[model samples]
Target: MSKRYIITGAPGTGKSSLLLQLQKEGIHCFSELSRKVIQHQQKLKGNKTPWGDILGFAELIYQKTIEELKSPVNEISFVDRGLADMTAYLTSQSYFIPGYLQHFPYKKYYKNTVFLLPPWKEIYVNDPQRPQTFKEAMQIHEHLIKTYKNLSFNIETLPKTTLTKRKEIILSLI
Candidate 1:
């Protein structure tokens, strides 16, 4: 079975940038689904969005993640985020996490080691897709750490550094 490594963190933490570089290096990578969902909702003027309906947005992301997991992979792959991220987001927003997600066996699909990119204030920025402030991002970061730890996955925080270095670190670790 191919090992599916997960690279996760709060918004604007350079997860996408690192993943892009990794993909350029010929590594199999699954991009984050939330941003895509947001863009699609915006284009369609739909209600499934974080700002409009968070619960609905969570369910959408959950479904997208499930579909992504079903894709065939012959080599070790990296996922931009994992199911626990949805739990973390819901928890941060004070919403009740769904029991289906709460009971899901995340370890059965993802690797035990999850690379958590810490919030970088210097590099963090708000855009059309990512509107979270740096402070909110930090709070979400804490929730992500707690959620993943509670799920019994080894949390590895990627240092705040250049994309090349971060890529090197992940490649070295995995």
Candidate 2:
């Protein structure tokens, strides 16, 4: 089986940038599910959004993750986010994490060491898609670390540096 790696952390932490850079380098990668859902919802004016229905959004991302994880591949694949991310967001929102996800075997689906990108205040910006404040971003970061640790994952925090340097760190670790 091909090794599965996940890059997860708070929003605006450059997860997407790093993933895109890795993809350009010919690495197999899965896009961030939550952002896709958000874009689609905005286009359709749908109620399944983080601002409207967080659980619904979480469910959508969880399903998307399952689908991507099912595909057959020879080389190692990197996922932008995983179940732990969804669960953390849900918990942060005061939503009850589904039992199915609470007991899901995270180690079986993702690599033991998960790369967590910390929030970069210098580069952080608020866009339509990412409206969380800096404080909120930090909270999300803490939650992500807690969630991963609860799952027994080896959390590897990425350095606070330029996008290029961040990409190098991930590539070297992988």
Best by TM-score: 1
lDDT of 2 at 1: 65
Q: What are the lDDT scores of the predictions, listed in order? A: 0.90, 0.85
Question: For residues 1-174, what per-residue lDDT tens digits would candidate 2 score against the true structure?
Answer: 676888998989889998888888888888888888999989999878777888888788878877877887546678888878988888777889987688877887788989999989987898877889999999889889989999888888999887788888888887
State model 2's lDDT: 0.85
CA shift at 117, candidate 1, in angstroms? Answer: 0.7
Clash counts for all predictions = 0, 0
lDDT of 1 by residue, 8-126 (tens): 99999999999999999898998889989999999998978867899999899988988888898747789888888989988998999998799988988889999999998889889
User: Which number leads on lDDT?
Assistant: 1
All models, RMSD in angstroms: 1.0, 1.3
The TM-scores, one per candidate, come to 0.96, 0.94
CA lDDT, candidate 2, residue 61? 80
Give the C-alpha miss distance for residue 79 in model 1, angstroms.
0.9
